[model samples]
Target: MRVTEVVLSVGIGMLFAIGTFLVLRRDLVRVIFGVIVLSQATNVYLITMGGIQGVAPVVGGHGGHGETAVTDPLVQALVLTAVVIGLATTAFALVLAYRVYEEHGTIDLDRLQGVER
Candidate 1:
């Protein structure tokens, strides 16, 4: 594992953590940006996982060194599915947020919905 790759992996992981934290924000705009960040982080993680050095797995060539570095296609597929799902989810969330804004003129959760005593 190269130092650059390690740094990139850590960076992507940090992005995911940051995005997750942003998603927990009460402001709707921050939440929307958080979702986008989360999606990007996931995509970056998938790409990083695919960066291993090895021949294509389909070749089935038995090299003497027997190094087991193969591209992780599964992660790629999972990331692809997740991106699509995230898009749909984001669209729905945006629509809901818009409705809230139309009805209440604000997207702040605490401001829009008062605490019930």
Candidate 2:
């Protein structure tokens, strides 16, 4: 494996670990942030799966180039969709959290769950 691949894999792993930890926290804000982190990690994984290439995947342009690899446009499209969806999802989560805070006067999971502590 190349250095870039190793770095990207490690980064994705770290993001997942941290995101999971934060999601399990008692704070709604932290949970929201964690979801964002997880989404970003997923994006990175998708990009890596497409492989690193210097040329675009265009027919009759660079497709005939010998020994040249073209980047997959499908993966890029998927990643772009994921990013937009992630943004929308994050915004929705924030709105929900805000509403919960306003109604309950607290963002703590335990407090929201009727726990005295």
Candidate 3:
């Protein structure tokens, strides 16, 4: 694997770990951060899997070639769509979180769930 890929993988791994930790928190804000981290980490993983190794997708993209060099566009398109959808999900989560806090008066999940008492 290339150095770029190795570094990115490490970073994304860290991000996913952090996300898991944040999700475990009782605060709703932590959960939001966790979701965002998870989304980004997932995108990173998808892009990393599509790595081309010293090659750019377009003949005229970053690594220009006469015409012979080209990565698959379908994977690229799918990644883009996934990113957009992830963003939309994050936005929706934020909205829902705000509403939840408004109704519950506290971001703490433990407090909101009365079964603990």
Candidate 4:
């Protein structure tokens, strides 16, 4: 594999690891952040899967005629859609966290568990 792919693979792994760590924490906010990180990692992985050594998938764009490679536009579109969905999900999660904090007076999952509903 190329050096760039190797580097990106390592970075993706690191992000996954960090996100997992945050997700296992007791803090509700940290869990939300972890979910966001995981989503971003997924987007990056999708883009990397589309390959990085090609021109944009535009019609009659730069590069030779029918000789140069074009990056996968489908992957780009999927990532864009994921980004918008992720934003909405994040906002919803934050609102839920806020409501939990308002009702329970704490954002810690452990503390929340002890409180009666």
Instruction: Give each model a TM-score.
Output: 0.71, 0.91, 0.79, 0.90
- Mark the 10 consecutive residues where model 1 has the least summed lDDT: 55-64
lDDT of 4 by residue, 30-93 (tens): 9999999999999999999988787767767565756778888898999999999999999999
The residue pairs found clashing in candidate 4 are none
The lDDT per prediction is 0.82, 0.90, 0.79, 0.91
Residue 18, model 3: lDDT of: 96
lDDT of 1 by residue, 2-110 (tens): 8989899789989999899999999898889898998889788777767656656666565647677777677777888888998898889899989999999989878
By TM-score, the candidates rank as: 2, 4, 3, 1
lDDT of 3 by residue, 1-117 (tens): 678877887898899999999989888888898988887788778766775553555444554445454556666788899889988988898889899988988778888886474
Clashes of each: 0, 0, 0, 0
Error of 1 at 21 (Å): 4.0
After the best TM-score superposition of candidate 3, give how far the Cα of residue 1 lies from its true spot, in angstroms: 4.1
Q: Give candidate 4 misplaced runs (Cα > 4 Å).
A: 61-66, 115-117
